[model samples]
Target: MTTKPAINLWSSSDHAAEYLSRAESVPHRTEGESALLEFIPPSTRRILDLGTGDGRLLALVKGELSERLRSEGTSPRVEAVAVDFSPAMLEAAARRFAGDPSVTIKIHNLDYPLPDLGKFDAVVSCFAIHHVTHERKRALYAEIYSLLNPGGVFCNLEHVASPTERLHDEMLSHLDKTPETEDPSNKLLDVETQLQWLQEIGFADVDCHWKWREFALLAGRVGAS
Candidate 1:
């Protein structure tokens, strides 16, 4: 029997638009996002947002860091780089960060190796990355590790695989989706395997910080020493 080829449809404008239209309604996602922010060190001065669709997560991180700094009476300007492959996403992200010299939006696909955009104090991704094959996911994690400054953190708010088919279907139902209606770009992996991969990649303090059904926040840090 011939195995069907893996497919990713995120490059299509219609698909990208459709996802953006409903991006806000993903259940318990805000809780997961809040959890992910706690891992970011207060001293972070630079950030990289991978697959930054509309710059939403980046905005939240930058805002949180700014607020934290302001409270301490030290406001060091934060710099951020937001990357995405889809033209529609890029456009939306550009609009979101417009006139903000702190954020730079770039076009890049996650299926290939990430470009050398310089090291980051913190690297983040949300509901992205899983668009690539499992092999690429592991490789991308390694690359993300390489891109981090020593002691920097990597936070990925992701859509992961449920352990059992029954749970997976149930998760879809919660999202008002069924298997046939879900995005074809999603190439879900189990959270346990992904957390293990982070540990194997030499990330210290690795763990799943938060999770609700198929949604999760996976984070780890480079050794501070």
Candidate 2:
């Protein structure tokens, strides 16, 4: 088997900095993220965020849940684990959630199998996971399936492979980037393959819920029964 390229950019400060700078500028990201949020069942109590860069998506989900609980006159406690291997990203996420006892930031490399963090009601990842090899990605999906409680959901907002070389180039151009400028860490796979992997791993209702060009929101649920 061919060895996968190491995700060097994730560990480098310059790469992390550049991504953080442009994080919010990715067009249509918010729309996909919003759609992902809507798919999460309201009764989620424990959530896990893989590759939680600066805890951005976690913060958004927490804020929304808090509001929902307040409006319903019910106190819903949410425990979240934010995992990232990048020192810079871990520090940024730690700082972002400092003094918030509900969140825990852990340094975890997704290239390997997940640690025993206990089961969660929902698991989320955003603009991450594409850095790992395709083989690792499939294994990780199976791991994620095992980590979820019954009826739990997994939502991944990912950068996926384009259908053709021309389309890939067009996507890069649309993002004002070139292949030479793209992150070497990216080992993007097609949406169909990922969704099929999820289904094969025993995640029910697997589907790509939303997509815009190369970005997609893939989700699945562990069966309740």
Candidate 3:
């Protein structure tokens, strides 16, 4: 007898469409996004956004950088690369960034090794990495570390596992979702293990920067310049 694979509906057009409709309303999402942006410095020249759904967070970050540049009355060039695997999501992001010469959108899955896209000053992901298996999550963290330049930062506005099933259910309830209705693609893991993995892998200043229920920001620096 053979066991079937886990269901990941993100690749489905309907699922991707459904998510885009509710993407803005996730509890404290803006707060999380705001906190994630603070870590990225204005001096960053290259950015990589992983699992960049519809390029929303990527756009926000770029916008913030632009605002900063405007305030300083100096314009510095910033280039961004956004990656996602779902065909529907890829199209959405490409369309979202269409005619924007600064952003380059690519299609790539998080379950596999990342493509050779050189290095980035900052790497970011928003609630997208938990879909991969727990083992792969650690490996991906390592890969992200390798892809960063010294003094670079990695910011992840992530969905993490609760300490108990009861808390997990409560979190879902707060989001107006139940176990039966929740996305089967989620493979949540505890924060401690992930932080430990980051430290063990040689990251500096690693921590869960902010959190609300299951939504948290995991950030780490590559090294001091």
Candidate 4:
């Protein structure tokens, strides 16, 4: 059954380690990440990375922003918060950013409402939001909208559902897995549905910014011009 898994394996070290070992090899992942970095404004001061698995995506965004600022001979400080519910993931992220005063790693489950971490100029998540139910997904988007600054952006590099079972099967084959063995925690929803949810939640410029097969980047802003 493609329904939600009865248990969340992500809390276990073995499951988190397995995913980390295979994380970089996901097809076109770098492409999607590059597109995500392009949308982040140069003036972004504070960032929140939801489900910050190993803090990889957050590292990329921070690196890009740092390099951009350095190129103009302007070095502005930036603050980052990396959040995940898994102890393994929290440990990995904390270690990755250790000794760096700019980043904070926090333990949080996306199934619940976001904590009062203050507003952010950009909120990002990569391949992590689909593990929650569809209802929570919408609510989380609403929460994200509320957490953003006036011109802030939310960019989610998500695992989305395909239109057909055949396509889904093909994608699984491409990843060298079957539905039987895939991560059962995924509560995949279509890109369009999520975009619509963002729009309905008062997001401006809601759209799918990029897509590669079952993977897509959904982006929306908090306020309009």
Q: Cα RMSD to native, each candidate?
A: 1.9, 1.4, 2.5, 1.7
Candidate 3 lDDT by residue in tens digits, 1-225 = 121245567888998999999998888999999999999977888999999989999999999988999899988888999999899998999899999899998888888999899899999999899888887888999999998999999999999999999999999998889999988888888888889999998899999999999999999999965
Q: What overall lDDT, based on C-alpha atoms, would model 2 receive against the true structure?
A: 0.90
Model 1: per-residue lDDT, tens digit, 27-116? 898999999989999979999999998889999999999999989999889999999989999999999888999998989988889988
TM-score of 3: 0.96
Model 4 misplaced regions, further than 4 Å: 1-6
User: How far in Å is the alpha carbon of 136 misplaced in model 3?
Assistant: 0.7
User: After superposition on all CA atoms, how large is the RMSD of candidate 2?
Assistant: 1.4
lDDT for 64 in candidate 2 is 78
For each candidate, the alpha-carbon lDDT, in order, equals 0.90, 0.90, 0.90, 0.91
User: Candidate 4: worst 10 consecutive residues by lDDT?
Assistant: 1-10
65-98 in candidate 4: lDDT tens per residue? 9999999999989999999999998999988999
Give all TM-scores, in the order shown.
0.96, 0.97, 0.96, 0.96
RMSD of 1: 1.9
Clashes within 3 Å, all models in order: 0, 0, 0, 0
